[model samples]
Structures are given as structure tokens and as C-alpha cells.
Target: MGQAMAGAYLDRGYAVTLWNRTASRADALVAHGAVLAPSAAAALEAGELVVLSLTDYAAVYAVLEPAAGALKGRTIVNLSSDTPEKTRAGAEWFAGHGAVQLTGGVTVSPAGVGQEESVILYSGPRAVFDRHRAALDVLAGVADHRGEDPGLAALLYQINMGIFWTAMLSYWQAIALAEANGLSATDILPFATDTSDSLAGFFTFYAGRIDAGDHTGDVDRLAMGAASVDHVLHTMADAGVDTTLPATVAALFERGMAAGYGADSFSRVMELIRAS
Candidate 1:
């Protein structure tokens, strides 16, 4: 990701200074007009706006700790993946060194960097963001500033990851079911794609009600969903496919039903979730 990001800057005629724990990892970017900094401090000193694209907060600290002195009066854009709480702590840590911290949650893979459709979620002081907006745009065409809170970007990213991983696992579950029934994944691909695409309408319809704290079952009831999930669980079981994911869904629906939300919309589970 670091290499891709640096390459993006270089492609746009920006002078990029590259550094990595394994210095050899940046050979390609170094060849393509990026200066190979000798150390993390050298890299920090090379640019006023430093971008940290490391593994996590731990790695970020390890790399930046030695360069804290050089960080004074600079801006640090941390694109590393970490929890919201850790991101908030990191912002405080940077502030102690007189450096401003900007949290960035990249929404695309390294290969997608610099693509027109790629997006990155950012959160920090609006003034600082505006100052570097043009340079940040070189990394992705769509850069959304979520809010002033440094953790907002990480929070949003985790929420997205939660949905994405579950939805992807559900697709895998469906594929396994198909394979067990003598239907190849190729045969079920179109249907799976259609089913995923159809959820957009459900989201749009429920967004207003969800925001209004209205989990009325006028559209769909938890009882109905529980029954449907039961059928899915059984179908997967009968097909000799793994039932772990479906069983987890079934448990949640059953819990909602038991919590007196049987006649309420499945969104009512949100309340139970919040209480927990």
C-alpha cells in the first residue's frame, strides 16, 4: 500500500520520499523518481506532510518514535488500519510532539490506489484537511472528511469492514450450498450478484425508519425473518454444508424474537445490540 501510494504521488509529478523497514521493499518506487530515505527520521525530515501506511498503530509508533523530534511542526496522515480508540490515542501522541495527526481509512486495495473510483475516509481539523486537500487527492479521487474527531474515520472503516466481511462470508455459505446441490458456483453467480444488489433497495427503504428509531414491522417482521433464516439453516444443514455462519444468524434472529421483537422489524435488533 505504501509503495502504491508513493507511486501515485510520483505519477502525478510530486516528489516522494520512500522508507520501509525492509528498505529493499521500496526499490521500485525509488527507481521511479522517489528518493530512498536512509531512515524514518530522514523520511520525516524530507516532507512536511508525512504519510504513514504501515501495518497498525504498533508499527506506526515503532517507526515514528525515533523521528518524534523531526515530526514537530509537520502533519502526519496515518492510513494504517487500527481501532478507533488507538487512532485517538495516536492523535494525542502526535499532538504532544507539536505535530498534527490526520486519520485516514483507505477503502480500496493497493492496486486500486489512484483510481478514479477509489475513496479514502479522513477525519481531523477541517483547516488542516483543506490545506492538504490537493495533495491528498493525488492518492484517490474521492476523499471524504468524516468529521473533526480523529477516530471517526476508523470507526466508519470498522463499520464498513463488519458489513463487508459478513456479507462476503454469506456469499461463501451460499456458494457452498450450491456446490453441495450439484450446482457449480458459475451457475449461481448471477443469482448471488442479484441478491446482493437487491439489498440496496432495502437499505434505502429502511434508512429513514432506522434514523427515526422506528422499527415498526410494517415492512418486514422479525418473526418472518426468523422463519426465513430457519429455513436457510435447515437447507444448508440438509445439503451437508457448513452451518456455522447460518447458525450464528439464526441465533441472533431467535434472540431478537425472544426479546419481544417478534412482531417488530429486524432493525429492532439494533436496540438489543445497543443495550448489550
Candidate 2:
């Protein structure tokens, strides 16, 4: 990701500096007219806006702790993945060093860096963001400034990632179920894609209902959803396939039903989740 970002900057005619724990890892960028910084401090000192695409907060802290002094009066854009609390703490850490910090979450893979279709979510002091907005746009065409709270970007990232991973898992489960019934994944591909594509409409419908706290059962009842989930579990079980995922879904739906939401919309499960 770092290499991708550096390449993007270089392409934009910016004087890019490269640094990595493994010196050889930066050879390509160095060959591409990016200066190879001798150390983290050298990299920090090389640019006023320091972009960090590290593994996590632990790595961020480990890399910057020794060069804390070099961060004074600089700006740190941390695109590391970690808990919101840790990201927020990192913002504070940079502040303590007299450096401005922006917590960022890139919504695309490294391959998508610098692409006009890609987005990068950011949260920090609005003034700091506005100051470097153009440069950040070099990394991704769409730079979404989420809020003043540094944790907001990370929060949004985690929420989307949670949905992404589980949705993929659900697709895999569907493929497995199809295979158990003598259908190849290729046979189900188009239908699976169509089903996933249809979710956008459901999201639009559910968002308004959820925000209004109106979990009306008129459209889709929790009881109906729970029963459907049970059927899914039974089907998986009867096929001699893994039932763990569907069983878990059924359990959650049952919990909502047991919570007196059987007559409410499936969205009523949020109430159970909140109470838990």
C-alpha cells in the first residue's frame, strides 16, 4: 500500500520519500525517483505531511515512538487498521508531539490506489484536512472527510469491513449449499450476483426505517425471518453441509423472537443487539 501511495505521489509530480523496515522493499519506488529515507526520523523530517500505511496501531507506535521529536509541527496521516479507540489514542499521541494527525481508512486495495473510483475516508481537525485535501486526493480520487473525531473514519471502515467479510462468507455458504445439492458454483454465479446486487434496495429501505426506530412488521415480520433462517439451517443440516453460519443466524433471529419482537420487523433485532 505504501509503495502504491508513493507511486501515486510520484506520478503527481510530488517529491516522494520512501522508507520501510526492510530496505529492499523500497527499491522499486527508489528507482522511480523517490528518495529512500535512512530511518523513520529521516522520513518524518523529509516531509511535512507524513503518510503511514502500517499494519496497525502497535506498529505505528513502535515506529514513531523513537522519533516522536521529529513529528513536532508535522502532519501525520495514519492509514493503519485498528480499533477506533486505538486510532483516537494515536491522534492524541501525535497531538502530544505537537503534530497534527488524521486517521484514515482506505476503502480499496493497493491496486486501486490513485484510481478515480477509489475512496479514502478521513477524520481529524477539519482545518488540517482542508490544508492537505489536494495531496490526499493524489492517493484516492474520492477523499471523504468523515468528521472532526479521528475515530469516525476507523468506525466507518470497521462497519463496512464487518459487512463485507460476512457477506462474502454468506456467498461461500451459498456456494457450498449449491454444491451439496449437485449444482456447480458456476451455475449459481449469476444468481448469487443478482441476489447481492439486490441488497442495495433493501439497504435504502431499511436505513430509513431503522433511523426512525420504526420496525413495523407490515413488510417483513421477525417471526417470518426467524422461520426462514431456521429453514436455512435445516436445509444445510439435511445436506450434510456445515450448518454453523446459518445456525448462528437462526439463533440470533430466535433471540429477537424470544424478546417479543416476533410480531415486529426483522430490524427489531437491533433492539436486542442494543440491549445486549
Candidate 3:
């Protein structure tokens, strides 16, 4: 994610300083006119606006701890895959140490960086964001302010990961089930790709219904959908395929059926999946 954002900043003519604990990682960026910060302190001293994209919360502190004095009055932009609590803690840590920090999420892959298709998100002082807006735009066309909470960006990021994960899982799971029926990867690739592409729109549209807590049978009714899923399970089992994913879905459907939602839409089963 850091590489993606950095590539964008470089593309947009923003002077970006690059660094990695593994120095070799910066070689490509350095070739692209990004000056390497020799050490953590040098990196902080090198730029007033610094961005840290590391592995986790612990790594954040490890990098900053060595450069505490160098960070005075600087701005820190962190775009790590961290939880919300970690984001809040890191933001507060930077504030206590005299840096104006911003928590951010990058929604684009490395290839999407510097293009309009990617989005970079921020959460912190709106005033600070306004001041830095021009520089941020170099990374993506859509750099958004989420809210006052520094954790909102990461929260959104994790939710997005769920969409990606389940989509990928659905594809692989379908392929696995088909392989049991003598379908090779090549045979299933086209259909899997096209079908998953079609289903991709469902997350967004269905998510609205899920969030609104509306189980109105807008598309397919629950009982009918459950019947279709039952077919999938039976096919998998008859072909000696493992039923882990379908089994979980069946569990949810069974719970929904018990709750008298068997006649409702498939999305009404969201209640069965909720923590409560």
C-alpha cells in the first residue's frame, strides 16, 4: 500500500522521501526520483510531512521511537493495515510527542496508485487535511476525509477487506466444488470470472439492505435461495468435495429457518450471522 501511494506521489510531482527498514526495498523508488531517508531520524529530518506504511502498530512505534526528537512539529501520515484502536493510540502517541498526525487508508492496489480509480482516505484534523490537500491529490483522484476519529479510515479498510475476501473465497470455493466433477481450472476459469464479476454488484446493493435492517424480499426469497444453496451442498457432497464453506452457509440458513425467516429474502439471514 505504501509503494502504491508513493508511486502516486511521485507521478503527481510531489517531492517524496522513501525509506524501508529493508533498505533494498527502496531501490526502485529511489530510481524514480524518491530520495531515500538513510535512517529513521534522517527520514523525519528529511521531510516536514512524513508517511509511515508499516506492518502493524508495533512497527509504527519501533520506527518513531528512534526519531522522537526529529519528529517535532512534523506531520505524520500512517497508512498501515491496523485496527481502529491501534489507529487511535498511534494518533494520540504522535500528538503527545508534538507531531500533527493523520490516519489514512489506501483503497487502491499498487497498480491503481496515481490513477482516478484508487482512493486514499484520511481521518484527523480537517484543517490539517485542507492544508495538505494538494499534495495528497497526487496519490489519487479521491482522497477523502472520513471524520474526526482517526480510526474511521482503518475501520472502513477492514470492512472492505471482508468484501474482497468473501468474493475471492466464493470463486475458489466454486472452483473447488467443480473440480470434484472433473472440471479443470481452465474449464471453470471463464465462468468463475464472469459469474463473480456479476455477483460483485450484489455486495453493494445487498449491503444497503443489510444495513437498513430491511428484510423485504426484494430479489430472491429466503426459502427459494436456501433451496438453491441446498443443491450446491448436495452436489459438493455427492462428488466427495469438502463442504466447509457450504456447511457454514447451511448453518446460517438453518438458524434463519428456525427463526421463521425461511419465507423471507436470503439477506434476512444476516441476522443469523450477526454477533448477537
Candidate 4:
């Protein structure tokens, strides 16, 4: 991702100074008119605005700590993934070194960087963000400034990832079930895609009701949903496919049923999840 971001900037005619633990990893960028900094400190000192695309906050400290002296007047944009708490702590750490930290959450893969559809969430001091907005826009089509809180970007990123992983896993489970029934994944592609696409409508319909704490079951009932899940579980079991995913889902629905939400909307299961 670091390489991609740097490449994006270099393509835009920005003077980029590249540095990595393995210096050879930046050979291509170096050939493209980007200066290859000899050390992390040199990279930090190269400009007032420093963009970091490390693995996590741990790696951020590992690289920056030894180069602390160069950070005093720099604004560090840390796009690494980590917990919100760690992000907040990192902001404080940067402040202690007389540097400003702008937290970022890149929503697209490296290949998507610099694309018009790509998004990057940011959070930090409003003034700092406004100052660098033009430069940041080079990295993504949507440089979404989430809020003044430095951790908001990380929080939203983690929440997005939570949905991403679970939704992808559900797709995988569907593919497995289809394969067990002698159907290729290609055969189920349209149906799976249609079902996945329909979720946005459901989410839109349920958001207001959920926010209002109204699980009236007018649209759907927990009892019916649970029964449907039961059929899915049994079908997978009969197909000789692993049932772990559906089993876990069925168990959750069963718990909701046992908790007397059987007559309510399945959305009421949110209560059970919250208590858990």
C-alpha cells in the first residue's frame, strides 16, 4: 500500500522520498524519479507531511521511535490498521514529540489507490486535515474526513472490516453448499450476487426501525427466520458439507427464540448480541 500511495503521488508529479526496511523493495519507484531515502529518519525529514502505511501501531513505533528527532515539525499521516484505542494513543504519542498525527483508514486495496471510486477515511484536527486536503485527495477519490477525533477513522475502518469478513465468509459458505450439490460456483454466481445485492435494501429498511428500537415483526419475524435457518442447516448437513457457519447462526437464532423474541422481528436478536 505504501508503494502504491507513493506511486500515486509520483504519478501526480509530487516529489516522493521512499524508504522501507528492505530498500530494494522500492527499486521500481526509485527508477521512477522518487528519491530513495537511506533511512527512516531521512524519510521523515524529507518533508513536513509524512505518510505511513505500516502494518500496525507497533510497526509505527518501531520505525518512528528511533527517528523521533525528525518528527518534531512533521505531520504524520498513519494509514495503518489497528484498534481505535491504539490510534488515540498514537495521536498522543505524536503530540508528545511535537508532531501531529492524522489517522487514516484506506477503504480500498492497493490496486484501487488513486482510483476515482476509492475512499479513504480520515480523522484528526480539522485544521490539519483542511491544510492537507488537496494532497490527500491525490491518494483517493473520496478523502472522507470523518471527524475531529483521531480514532474515528480507525473505528469506522474496523467496523467496515467486521462486515466485510463476515459477509465474504457467508458467500464462501454458500459456494461450499452449492459445490456439495454438484453445482459449480459459477452456476450460483448470479443468485449469490442477487442475494448479496438485496442486503442494501434490507439495511436501509431496517436502519430507522433499529434506531427507533422498533422490532415489531411487521416485515419479518424471528420464528420464521429461525425456521429458515434450520432448513439451511439441515440442507448443508444432508449435503455432507461443513455446517459450522450455519450451525453458529442457527444457535444464535435459537438463543433469540429461547429469550422470548420468537414473536418479534429477527432484528431483536441485536438485543441478545448486545447482552452477550
Best by lDDT: 4
* lDDT of candidate 2 over 1-276, digit per residue (tens): 988999999999999986899999899898889999899999999979999999999999899899898999999999999999999989999999999889899999999999999999999999999999899999998999989999999999999899999999999999999999999999999999999999999999999999999999999999999889988999999999998899889999989988899999999999877845
Estimate every model's Cα lDDT from 0 to 1: 0.93, 0.93, 0.83, 0.95
Which runs of model 2 end up more than 4 angstroms from their true locations? none
Evaluated at residue 20, the lDDT of candidate 3 is 85
Clashes of each: 0, 0, 1, 0
Error of 2 at 161 (Å): 0.9
Using Cα atoms with residue i matched to residue i, what is each candidate's TM-score against the true structure?
0.96, 0.96, 0.88, 0.97
TM-score rank, highest first?
Answer: 4, 1, 2, 3
- For candidate 1, the TM-score is 0.96
Q: For candidate 1, what's the RMSD?
A: 1.3
lDDT of 1 by residue, 25-57 (tens): 888888899999899999989979999998899
Total clashing pairs in model 4: 0
Which lDDT value does model 3 have at 63? Answer: 81
Residue-wise lDDT of candidate 4 within 57-129, one digit each (tens)?
9999998899998899899999999999999999999999999999999999999999999999999998999
Error of 1 at 178 (Å): 1.3
Comparing 2 with 4 on TM-score, the higher-scoring candidate is 4
Cα distance off (Å), candidate 1, residue 62: 1.4
Worst 10 residues of 4 by lDDT: 267-276
